[model samples]
Target: MAVQSPSLDDPRVLVDTPAAIVDAIPPYAPRSEREAEFYALGDGQMLLNIGPHHPATHGVLRIVLKIEGERIVDLDPVLGYLHRGVEKLAENADYHHSIAYTDPLEYVSSLFNELAPVMAFERLLDLRVPRRAEYLRVLSCELLRVSSHILFMGFMALDMGGLTPILYSFIERDEMVDMLAALTGQRMLFNYMRIGGVNGDLNHEFLSRLGDWMSRAGRQAEAISTLLNENEIFVKRTRGLGAISRGQALNLGLTGPNLRACGVPFDVRRAHPYSVYPELDFDVVTADEGDTYARYLVRVEEIKQSIRIIDQVLHEMPDGPVMARIPRRITPPPGRAWAAIESPRGQYGCYAMSDGTDQPYRFRIHDPSFVNLQALVPILPGCLIADTMAVNASLDPIMGGVDK
Candidate 1:
């Protein structure tokens, strides 16, 4: 019997070949460049461009992958497609005016982005926010975190093949957004925090309503947890998927729930203690599995913890001015400083370089989504393609945050 070898020119072979095989073919390129530079050194392997729009790419992300069978040999993540030149725009805007731009940078968690820039500006000007203002900021930030996490939980469940939970999650989120909208006048992109304090005080009626909403939200969260937590399908889909160990997560700069899922008790609220966090009592949630399930569990527990923090801030909130006594045209001395807050996703920081002007000389944002995306390369190789969406959703990255 004669064995037929596969021929590259055979149309049948090309047509019948699997996508993995088709992806192995190298694209034609210029030969003027160094071979070692143009092509990876050593044995030739087919390179495939996964996407700038692939659902699993997270958002507007392009990944160059060298794969052999189901195993990813090498991976390169390409970003910047969503970049809107926010940092550059901030340089041109005056100190107070820049808050508008930061609000859109992390669209999902705009409140935190606003907080980062305004808080940095406040620090630069040595502005003192009133105790009431501090508590308000804490309350709102925690609420924003809870709102963001609820969205994540819903979307993640959707990616995991459960759709009902997302609707339930969004029902809770809509209520929270309505509550925030009542206070800030904007649902998602709220430029509510100013250099010295919040935009306005929470009226007594608003507080009374918020307290009632909080009670209802707490009960809703508990109900949702009971429905999803014990569901066999959810457990099977999430459990033991996309595992990341503590040391690896630390090296990759993973923060927030992604870091906490690895059993590392390093929350900015607890570790650094900013805002009114020092006075508020709340537990830092952690999980040992460092897997998708662990990440989900960490966030679920975090929502509960945020409730505890908000309750304390509301109960003990003091009465005073919300803004500082800084001059109308504020300017700080030439200096640089870093300020980080416990955003819904993780540690969101702003590194501001001022040149003794109202406008910042240079502003750099250390967004957690961008940092957390790094962990994908190490973890993607061993998992199946279906699990790609699972892992990406587990990371819960917002492209605006990553690109900005």
Candidate 2:
């Protein structure tokens, strides 16, 4: 009938008492099994609402945590605060203009977000992409991958209570953005990749900046790695926290750095080579320890791999037209096509169907954030409130992509 709530600051709650707590609190009626279970909390357990507005994702992600003092008992992740019906909007625009609609889905890695649809449309039209254009696509996507990962590293550390990492990360990330802006005409939502080819070629200003940045990019990355790889606070907070086993990663259907951190070599680029990735020389980085620390380390190594990829792309970039010769108005025969890319988050995919019209009959996307966010429900249970934040950042689910 009555109970005293446990204090997180007190040591008594950390250990089990002879009489365990159960079902001493009551509230609103159940909506679903998950909500019913959450509502039926053990004695002393209380529900904590994290946010309908949080920064880990660009827009909003709400998390309802059931906690007994400081330790999390279970959590319910709420999404869909930033969905803009991007796929529905694409169905109305012509092929050339439809690429613009995909830009905002994954704002941090906008180029790859645009590329999947472009490739899918290319498939629908049976268009042959230029050789040089393929290389440029790889180059831009790799750079975007690094930038996205850099933002992840900074914010992941920030979530774990490190301010310096974010500041240092932005300094390097801004330079890469400037280089991309030179090539793509704008910094954020590029809309550069066309159905057959890309919007532009490697220009003088972009190349000049790329060469300079390439010279020290490796060293800059090394410096940041050195800064975080062994810092006592960083290591202590993340080393064994929020660990995902190899089986868990696969069973949860995770991909990208999150899955790779669990030691599965299932990169969409390597597993199913598309674009110019087959031509590039780089190893698929993985870690045996699939914890929050491993996730962070995997992305750091990926930055190096991306840098190597960019260098090779620069040296081997061939001379040719970046845009394919296609009519301004695209009206493909009735057909359906699908294309998937290894986005910073995970496997970013798009499926398009054309019914002999300028616009797609149906356009749909599979954003990795949506799939990857499911892992949190399984992984966050025993974590402390602070550890939950760190784990969320380590997984790096962008609300823009997840909600879209």
Candidate 3:
């Protein structure tokens, strides 16, 4: 039997040739000239682009990173992929109609986004909301917060290599969103909050389910905490990873769980009271460690706080009109008004300027995802490539809110 030598023309033989392989590959080029500045492929550093469409980014967020081995030496977040010109659209829409446009600013917690614009309109028009309306608003917003946080916890754990928590979180979140849908008619994007007040009142069925959810929320939280809180891998991955000090967090304009995790008791609900938050009894959940683990704990504890607030609202809810006595067409006096609240992510604020017209002269949003996302540039450096997902998950930025 003759043993034939491997042919040089063979695809396998060609791939094995070092010179042929090098010749086959082309030199890398920057996507744009502006992007050229991000390249620092000198010595041991190499340029890495994470995604405009990465699952770990949580949305359509792209991050350019310079890595030395597995450690990120520098990073720049590329934003605006999901921008929809929400502010410009709100400007042209009627004050009453503008509530609909604000819903997508923070797509996950649409109630909070809607709340900002409606609250601004109420202030802009100097409209007095009924006490019952205030109570209902608190109830709806807290429900939305819990729902958002539940899903956020799931995603965070999932990013950190735990799959069970995401499912457990969705279990709670689905029920919460179902209750919200019953009250608001929509699940994810709720345009339920009107200019003066909410579109409709919560019915007995919604309230009953809410009571049941409130009862089981503690047990569910405990179960989740038990599953992930002490897991050695989770603890090692998140503990002391991407730690942000109190000053750094505040300086970066971090809020909500991210800020609280840094030991700053700067809840917009407590520090800057809005709606019926002043009347509600709840403690600001905080932690000394501002790492990924601390952020997780802060959010879980916050779920309990939100439940407590909803309980208070239920007990003290007044019997009055759900909608304020405002005309069909809302035209605020020619002036500017700003309203902000503790959104699930952080401070979700809206600024509206009227020029004595039905449409707003100017409209702007101060989204927490946008602001808290800034903290990433600072926290990302010195963190390992594997830890990037964990750190970004801790921030929990939604591109809808970040880019809006």
Candidate 4:
């Protein structure tokens, strides 16, 4: 038996297909300099500006990518769009006045931002934070960590085109924020942590609400896991993508879950033991595979650990003054001190130098998002152009922190 093929000369098929029209068209000279420049791209690679506005960027993050077709040749992450000159602003303000300015650094996990400066100021002035205050600090910090990671996981999934996870994650996040608001006045940027301790003690309503949220946390966590963790599309998109070795992660100054994802057991709370972290018993979560999926898993595991820490803090909470006894005006002698905390993003630290006056001589912050963001420079090369968003999401550099 023989099979007859359709002929290219068939007018009906030719008109229906693109080939006949393309062949019929005649080539013309470049009409202007713009047309000539556009045609010149045929012989060379192209540079694309993804955004200072695209949705996947998380903030006002612009990534300039040089590519050869679908393969990325180079990527440059542009920052400073959200910069408020926080360090400079803090230097001009009084030691106590500067605490509020730190809130926007990592806006999602604002408690950690507040914690760094408060700890630094406490160390600089040799102020003693009460045991009850320390427990409150740990509880607030851990709750913020859990809340930040939940949003991070949701955004990571959202970048990969999953919407349900963000919706479900927000449900949990609002509950946590609501409880935090009952303690402090604000929900997101709760400038809760003060120099000696927290602004106020956790109220009964906040405690009762926290207990309710903790009880059902596992179910909500499982909902997100079911949506993404083992899904074929999520796995295929992330499993082996943007892998970094342990040494490279260390060399790049990666920290938090991004660093832990590379199998490094370095956590500021565990290693340096700040506040009540030394008293708390919780395992530092790490993943051997340093890929996007591994980063996701590390955050999820850390959320569980944070919940465990919160439970312990609640159970063993001591009764004492939430705020330490201190002078009305804080005028520390000339001294410099640095303090760090394990934020959801990484090692968030603040350095303060007192000049014998009320204001700090110099105030600086070490934002983990800024350090973790550099990981993308090494990880992005050779990845497909589409994978750029996935890699950025895994790095999770909040521009508020990065550009502060």
Q: What TM-score goes with each of the models? A: 0.87, 0.91, 0.90, 0.89
Model 2 C-alpha lDDT per residue in residues 1-404, reported as the tens digit of each score: 77978887777766644222322223457778877777676888887777776655345888878898999999888777887888778888888787898898888899988999999989988889999999999999998888888888888877777788788788878988899999999999988898889889888999899889887876666766787999999999999988899998999999999999999988999999999888889989999899999999999999999998988998998998988899889999999999999998889999999999899999999999888889989998988987878888888888888988
Among the numbered candidates, top TM-score falls to: 2
lDDT score of model 1? 0.82
After best superposition, candidate 4 residue 257: deviation in angstroms? 0.6
Of candidates 4 and 3, the better by TM-score: 3
Number of the candidate with higher TM-score, 1 or 4: 4
Shift of residue 216 alpha carbon in model 4, Å: 0.8
Residue pairs whose backbone atoms clash in candidate 2: 22-43
True-structure lDDT of candidate 2 = 0.86
Candidate 2 stretches greater than 4 Å from native: 1-29, 55-58
Residue 1 lDDT (model 3): 88
Between candidates 2 and 3, name the one with more favorable TM-score.
2
Which consecutive 10 residues in model 2 have the weakest lDDT in total?
18-27
RMSD of each: 6.2, 6.7, 5.9, 10.6
Please list all clashing residue pairs in model 4, or write none if there are none. none
